[model samples]
Target: MPDFSKLYDDLKRARDEIKLKIHLGSKDAQDEWAELERRWATFENKAELERSAKDVSDAVKILGSELKDAFQRVRKAL
Candidate 1:
């Protein structure tokens, strides 16, 4: 059988990293929003692009979390 414990630990670490990146990205986005507003005084397509990018980033983080949870379950099963 596979080394499920090791797999779980690895997946958990990956999930943590994803979470950290998401947090950092969020802060960066806030800064970006401030800069955009200061420069333009109004919203525009760039904001939409940022939102879309953030959505994709969040989706990846969620997927990573789900994968880690699935791996943990499999580890338990094994």
Candidate 2:
């Protein structure tokens, strides 16, 4: 099974970095956020291929929910 804990950590770190950049009004923060989006997309896509279809679907659902929450925090920080 995919290590969701690790994924969650990565997401958190990305969000933290994004918030820091936004707080500092750095242009590089935009680039960092874009990179985070790309990483998240790639990880989600690969997670879909590493298990049974049902498992993959469930994982995606969980990840999506977690990401939504993370994004909310990011928005608040902005």
Candidate 3:
């Protein structure tokens, strides 16, 4: 199983950096950020309930991929 903490933290850091750099004035960017944040919380809740690192890692991977795409859109909007 991959390290959920490391993976999640890395993604979180990257997302945060992108968010900090962007104005987030566009509706798309705001929506994407909101979705990402919602998913982040859901993944954390799932990890807490399941107590399975692999499951958490998998969930985080999906979220990370979405976050990358979303951030790309946000970058384009900037």
Candidate 4:
């Protein structure tokens, strides 16, 4: 089982940084940020960002991947 602590930590940090950058970003980024925030609560709970892959459900792993990609897109937008 792969450890996701680092993956989660990196993305979470990026998420925070992007949040601050949102004010300087466009309306589209803001809208995406809102949606990401909504989804983030659920993602955060399901993904403590420390548990191993075997400890987490496949659904969560998938969500994490999605969030990673979504966050990257948001970063590009900013």
TM-score of 1: 0.41
Q: Model 1, 1-78: lDDT tens per residue? A: 146446645755765565555545777776764574465433334555666787899999999999999999999999
Count of clashes, each model: 0, 0, 0, 0
Q: Which model scores highest in TM-score?
A: 4
Number of colliding residue pairs in model 3: 0
Runs with alpha carbons beyond 4 Å of true place in candidate 3: 50-78
What lDDT score belongs to each candidate, Candidate 1 first? 0.66, 0.75, 0.80, 0.82
> Model 4, 63: alpha-carbon shift in Å?
32
lDDT-wise, the better of 3 and 4 is 4
- Candidate topping lDDT: 4
Taking every candidate in turn, the Cα RMSD to the unseen true structure, in Å, is 18.1, 19.3, 22.0, 20.4
For residues 1-78, write the lDDT of model 4, one tens digit per residue.
334667778889999998888999889988999999999888887785535454567778899999999999999999
Q: Output the TM-score of candidate 4.
A: 0.56
Candidate 4 collision pairs? none
- Residue-level lDDT for 72 in candidate 1: 100
**Model 2, clash count?**
0
What tens digits encode model 2's per-residue C-alpha lDDT throughout 1-78? 347657756876877776665756666767776786788778767665655576769999999999999999999999
Error of 3 at 20 (Å): 1.3
